[model samples]
Target: MYAVIRVRGRTGIKKNIADNLNMLNLTRISHATVIPETPSYDGMLQKGKDYITWGEISEDTLKELISVRGRLPGDKRVTDEYVKENTDYDSVDALATAIFNQETTMKDAGLKPIFRLNPPRKGYEGTKKPYTEGGSLGYRSENINELIEKMI
Candidate 1:
């Protein structure tokens, strides 16, 4: 799966890019969503590339993200007990494994789809430029895990 995070604000955004980000459920800066890797999602990510960052998420990062940021319907922190009670998984780690393996989704696992993250610890390097140029926008490949760690 690809972990996508909105990096820019809505002001001055073009309608189509805004629509793409909205469709991805990234309506605000620092908001993130995980999506299966697919052609349509790729197109959407490309459309909003100037205002977001994304890449394949590592299982360890994904697990930490879920354990630290995952929430339930009533804004409760997701725990192993909750996972056992609400889903087939016996622990949060198992759920994370399942999600990483594409065997389940956050929604199906009874977690909220959107993860509201704090801005990266040291903030972005440069939000206006692409990741290839030492900026925080655009795809960052496995470096996305480092970024996520900072945010978490």
Candidate 2:
């Protein structure tokens, strides 16, 4: 049973975490993080002044992480019909949990709650499928490759 927590942050006080936590659903941070220096993209670059932004989370990297994990072993979230169908990948938190609750876990990386779904036998089997005969070992071995690929 995955605990689904609804997240609501402030663009007012929490604007710094806007991107990283945007897709997640958590009302409050399990823990708080603070840092001094914010990295500037213009530093050492032959360019004009730009917003020296810094905090956790990046859209490109996050997408890459999810895609990478989806293709790796032990990560079966890729097979999630819920994820595959949706054009926009929601945060890995309860937002996705409402779709298929195969035991989700909450992650506190910022003010937002990120989530990763627990793979069914190492992947998604849609929530309705006779993928195995009462969850047997032989049944799993027979579908192991499918399970691995689908999890991505």
Q: Which candidate comes out best when scored by lDDT? A: 1
Off by over 4 Å in 1: none
Each model's number of backbone clashes? 0, 11
lDDT of 2 by residue, 43-95 (tens): 21112101111123322333333444422234345434444354233543333
**Each candidate's root-mean-square deviation in Å?**
0.8, 19.4
Model 1 lDDT per residue over 7-106, tens place: 9999999998898899999999999888999999999999899999999999998999999999999999999888999899999999999999999999
Whole-model lDDT, model 2: 0.28
TM accuracy, model 2? 0.19
List residue ranges in candidate 2 displaced over 4 A.
Answer: 1-55, 70-75, 79-82, 85-152
